[model samples]
Target: MRDDIVTIEPDEGLRTWGWVSYLLHLVVAVAAVLPGAQVSIALLVVALVIDLVKKGDAANTWQASHFSWRIRSVVWAGVLYLLTSWLWLLFIIPGWIAWGLISIWFLYRIVKGMMRMNAGLSVETA
Candidate 1:
């Protein structure tokens, strides 16, 4: 069961999973909007776990050098955490609902790939 968890970087940063992460998030977001929020909640749990399992310096992954979204990553990570917890509570009760709160921090991820190229440095050095 523990194998279900995958932490590519034991003591590093977010792992690369191509653009699929965004698609997964999109699905989760839609699920949150639906009447039954289970799908979204599960997705959120997985996502939150992914973030938690990852280990590394925040200033790496080539996103840190940029003066742009790198800062946003930290903020977004925090926001995701809160939203996930809120959703966990919501899933516990049927009547309860979680207002969709889009984490603005996500933009940093898409921009992160480019920021890596633009800055020519990973989070550690930049």
Candidate 2:
């Protein structure tokens, strides 16, 4: 009756940065989906800084857990955005729909990760 091909381990949880990371994810989602707002790299820098500062000198789970897998994911997001920009120019409607779908998918993953982290922490305290 179940369809999940992969099962997540119980011990792993979201990174320590937690809320800050989720907020940064929101920033990234907004920027990616609303790319027409134009050349504003400041916010992206802000997101990156927030990730680093909020994370502090703590062990890096994201960049190291999968050995830069997150880096590659972020890079792939950039690629998708760039490719979609061209598509947007070609045809406005479908382009935005695709962008919205992709953005939502990314946001869902971030939020799900955060929720699992929160759930684990709660159970630990309980």
Q: Pick the candidate with the highest TM-score.
A: 2
Residue 32 of model 1, lDDT score: 51
lDDT of 1 by residue, 1-126 (tens): 133333232222233422233345545545554565455356545544444333233223332233233334435655665656666665744223223333333433535444553344443333
Lowest lDDT sum, 10 consecutive residues, model 2, at 60-69
Point to the candidate with the largest lDDT.
2
- What TM-score does each of the candidates earn? 0.35, 0.54
Query: What shift in Å separates residue 27 of candidate 2 from its native position after superposition?
Result: 4.6
Clash statistics: count for each candidate: 5, 0
